[model samples]
Target: MIRDMAKGLNFPEEATAFLGECFDKITALEDGNDQLALAMDAFFASKDYASILNRLAEQTGIHRYSVDMVFLLLCADSLHDIYYIKELPEELFHNTMMDLKCKLLECKALHGIWGTFVTDWLQGYFHLKRYALGRLQYNTIEFPYEDYKGILKKGDRVLSCHIPSGAPLLIEDVLDSLKQAYAFYPDELRDGVLPITCHSWLLYAPHYEVFPEHSNLRKFYDLFTVIDNEATEGSNLDRIFNVTETDDYSTLAETTTLQKRFKKYLMDGNVMGEGFGILLFDGEKIL
Candidate 1:
């Protein structure tokens, strides 16, 4: 069953198993008394991710940030409880490569289905062709590392819609809806970032955006692919993208498409987020 799901992702089998192992180990908490101590250790160590990336670059002949992004994505996928492919803003996934590693230390499983969440709005707004090479804006949070877990919660929704909402939302309405949708997330959908909004109408709402902190990682690196590429011939691609629904079923239909496509992709392909990387080379290296 696992193999079937990993196929669509087109990832190496060894990598998938490695991630599964990491997920299992973290969740198998025999002791809960050391949560604070464990968190302390992780917090300090996280600051060195950049150094770790440099070391890996020296060892593997890859750029520092490129290797870091891959490491982050791998760590994120390894610890998540679900996976899905969708468009998302570049800002939200800013530290996604680093944030995923942080998430694993705490052992939280991410969740989301395949394609039941795609729309025209998601497509145009969250394209890799535009944001992959952009600079990511940074912010100071209350608990940078501890609160990192919440990043994926935002990521799941962003990827599903292909839109980045630039600013973070403390909207009470969306959080409420997320509570219900998440409870019903399936058993087979074992791992990656998952999002559930507090707004019921927004669950499959036609037009919504992911809070800036949790957009797709590819966007952060300014990466684009032939698959997500499009010709932007004088269109307002930069304006705040919104999806206006013709009827209630518009979002429901989009969500359904996301589900059907994700199932087939997982069953027949490799794991999501384990695709070809764009930052494989530094600016000086020859392709």
Candidate 2:
């Protein structure tokens, strides 16, 4: 049940166990282990990699503490999804994470402050928002785009709105887009494709959500999904051309076997309405 709470997230069984151990540490702290308690507390509170490292460094006498364990904790906390983690012994895992961290730091030193860290922040925000939806048990629509509707401009900012369907997103087009982002931010992709899972609509912005299944309240549900380090519960829809209540959203009115169910839902006038989609992009205009 715990494993299944996380669907889209992928990680090794040992790493999974390690994550559980982390929670257990939280529990056991009440029994004893002062250093462990303090260190873990700091880690849980850390918002960025630099802060995370600094917190651990501050506690020199942490009993039974290893840099690798902290590294593992940081990675797990930062990415939310541990699927990309290499299943290695504690020493090796720590070594790998440290290498990545040091590289990122070095990139910052050479490329100035905002190079790689900003990218991490963006991807983190993307996943965090998706996790929020998953927490509500919101099932996202992962549909395909075969025709030219419109393409989303790509960058690092949390999308404020869903992009409208204009040009059809072909398979090649999707791959090319992913490739470009990967090329632009190669270091972040070292673990694999940095995930970008958002709701059909931009939930990060202060908007309204119609939860007919649960309530009639129109409240903001656009919480960043990455905030939940455990990712034990959340929803995320990441695909080439994800559908939303966006621009010309009614253009999806053409009922077909591919997305008949989704189309019917959109047509139902329930959770999603038409033309509420907004695509987010930064940097390159061609993205």
Using lDDT, give the best candidate's number: 2
lDDT of 2 by residue, 1-287 (tens): 22222211333355345434543443344433444445445444543444433344344432222232333344444443342353424432232223233333333344332113233432332232321110111112332232212332233322222222223424344334434443434333312433333344333222133222222111223222311121111122111113312544355533433244434444565333222232222323222
Q: Candidate 2 regions off by >4 Å?
A: 1-8, 31-123, 126-287
CA deviation > 4 Å runs, candidate 1: 1-45, 77-287
With candidate 2 superimposed using the best TM-score fit, by how many Å does residue 237's alpha carbon deviate from the native?
32
lDDT of 1 by residue, 228-287 (tens): 222222222112112222122223222333334433433443223211111111222212
lDDT of each: 0.28, 0.32
